[model samples]
Target: MALNSGNGTVPDSKLGDEHVAVQKLQPDAKIYDRLMTLSGFFKQQYGDEPEFYVRVPGRVNIIGEHVDYCGYSVLPMAVEQSIILAVGTNKQRAQLELHHLDEGKFQSFDCDLSDLEIKLPKTGGPGWYSYFLCGIKGIQEELNDKWRPIGMRIALSGNVPLAAGLSSSSALVSAAVLATGHAQGMPLDRKQLASISASCEQYIGTHSGGMDQAIAYLAKQGCAQHIEFHPKLKGTPVTLPAGSCFVVANSLVQKRKAASSDYNERVVECRLATRWLAKSQKLPNWKDLIRFVDLQEACHLDNDAYVKLIDQQLKKSIYTREDICEGLGITEQELETDFLTPSTQHMQQFKLRQRALHVIQEAGRVVKFRQICEQLQRRSSKQDIEQLGQLMQESHHSLRELYECSHPDLERLVALSAKQGVSARVTGAGWGGCIVAMCDSVKAASDYVNVLKREYYAQLPAHLLERYQPNDFNEVVFATFPSNGAELFVQ
Candidate 1:
């Protein structure tokens, strides 16, 4: 059976019963050559042609940051960069053979599909294959009744930068899940796969909200999606301004979310602050509340009212562990086990006021950002466009100050972007990642790229600088628009 194709749905076409249809890449497409290369490599490695391939694209958040898990909407678009997998199933064996295009960087691994174990590192992050395993396990869990372990030889190739906050890891996991599902001939839907991908990623130990996976499956070409999570997982396509373009520039500093507690620590703080605010409002079962959005709904307040509530309830800028336990009437052990994530269970002070303030205010910004984009679609003008840019600037400031997720390199990139009159902010979970900057036109984007090359890339270490060519620096910085969502092809 063929998958449903909707306006914002993933483009997944299933093979016919005869399995004779062959999916071919468009000759003029940018990734056509790369796909052909991977197909050749798969033939050499597995000694046969692959059955099908999967493509999942990485995304760059335009404005929203660190507020998705708080149950707020985010505006993001999928980039041209993506992860591609070439697969061939072996019905006789129960093992999975995984290979990467870059053999030296990623070693090949074979594992039994029936018993998959994802081992988190004692320190730092899990191995690369752990992400793949997360996807496989997700599909297996979804198909529990009809699941049968099948052997598969897969070859992976990708251009998305690793750990630069561009959603590369999530894209890989999404691809793996799609590949596994297609190989098993199980029916798949975009929404269901997105939900599964988000939940299954926790196996690698990052408390992510579902933004990356949602966009990876629901994105459409030439449009940015306003994805809301509180009410439901739905994406509304927002047409960008006529002349404006978005440029992504990496800070070259990698932040692996699973390797450190910084990302989860923020998550813990937000949850604690939510409960604290809920109690202040005398809401029933306040202790059960974990997301700020839920508290807002229970209080029957708008975003502005919620911002005031943050100031009224969470008075103290910082709350110690003792203070939190006392306020909630819970023991420290309960707080550790129930409230905090395992990675952030250590003794520490929580910045309830700043974190909550950032979340509430950032949530408002997402609304305003979407509103401005909608307005621009109706009437595009210089002043209206500047208003959107100004909102992006405010977002970066809040992320840098209140959220404390921005890295020095990110701040520098933002500062440099300002010099070029571009509005930019840290895109993903921050702390060293790419910044998405909005420029007026293609020429304006070209000028901004040149400025960054001269001011920022020139200052890098000699070794790093030598690896990048002056003429071809598109990998580090490039202008992008929305692209199609995840796709599956049978050959």
Candidate 2:
């Protein structure tokens, strides 16, 4: 029961980076407690020594929420929050052992890399842990003939909230992939790992656009990335204005599965729009256009339908015959072949016209926004900071009106931000989640947190309250251009 006494090596309780940095730092405390806790269970079951531990972080979308799947740009940063895993390798047989910190339960499964088929007693098990295993199956597929031999024991812990739209599940899988890859001495680059992790995430039936795994594999300390997804994955650093901070406030409201159909439903609509766009653009497929939304617009459908449910009025709403002719610069006879009935009609349209425009425009804005931040860095000016804030406000409004991701909680947060004269917006896929706000002044941030605490979150359910409060001043995040993908750390 002594702290830091695992494996007969006493770790200096005060000697780790985490402990020194966090004021009450105890690196070995977590390690020891997990080891002792896990060792007792393993002894009672398999009677063996566990292997190494692993850790990975969940991320927040600073801007560009649901646009990743649309083949557009996104700005996301990995949060300090992480999922820590301790794995005990048992290569004795074709099997894997797993455990969770909170559930305190053990699961053993045969290590069948070749089958890749899942035998789930129930479709959904526990929280997001099932998705983490799916990522492993994905890595197995990548191995082809070179799949290694291994069994695993895992202990999981972290502060990231599940179903909050943060990349918590992805982080756990990334960590598992990294740990397994390292333990087996398998050679996989960050890109390979990212691809594998993303592929696995898809197996869970959530068809993500690869942004989370890419960032999880490539993130570094102190910066945000602007990622461009398509034919090839490329990332650039998002340089933030000097003296500005990246502040994220979790709404603590989990998006309910049944109530949150709007999210994935829009994704399906976007796919349909792309098919229509491909036909209209005279291209073989929407994939040929390089941009999904652009192809959607070319089809003469309102773009917002892809982000939210577009009403019948909005669907019928269109430019006049003359306007269409003028817009595309073609007569009605030419328009029939060019615009109407192009072998790809009868599509279900969501009211994403404005949402589509916002994504396209916002993708462009990210570039300009980066340039502006760099310009401010060169000159050290406050005007550009305010300008950036203006852009954030604009982006939020566009997401609200066009993207339709903002919910009532998001709006209240935005309104509170406006009163403080700070620029803030719904930070993730919206519809319900957290908001990212740029504090005009440290004093203002402090005051806003006070109001938020006093009015809204304080009276909520006893279990739900502020995870953490904001300070008065904005903490400036560098937010440079692209960085590396998710990676493994070995000593």
Best by lDDT: 1
Worst 10 residues of 2 by lDDT: 16-25
In candidate 1, which residue ranges exceed 4 Å CA deviation?
A: 1-24
TM-score: model 2 vs. ground truth: 0.73
- lDDT by residue (1-491, candidate 1, tens digit) is 44433332223245421121224445555566777899999999988998887889999999888888889999999998999999999899889999999999999988988778888879878888899999999888888878887888999999998899999999999999888887887666777888889989888888888999989988888999999997888889999888888999999999999898999999989999999998988888998899989988888989889888888878887899999999988999999888987788784899999999898888888888888889887876788889899989999899889989998999899999988788999999999989999998999999999999889988888777777765466688889989877877654
Model 2: how far residue 77 lies from native, Å: 1.4
Estimate the TM-score of every prediction.
0.95, 0.73
lDDT of 1 at 254: 95
Point out the worst 10-residue segment of candidate 1 by lDDT: 15-24
**Candidate 2 lDDT, tens digit per residue, 1-491?**
22633322343444331111111223444334544555465555556654555556678776676677787777777776667665666666545656565654334444454344654333233345565567667767777566776766665666566656666767877877776676566665666777778777655555567788778766655677777776567766666654565556556666632223465555654554444335444665544443464564555544344333223312432335555444344676754554343222222344435544566567655666677767976797778787878778888888888777778877876786687677888865677767777765555556666666665565556434333324221211111222223432212
lDDT of each: 0.86, 0.58
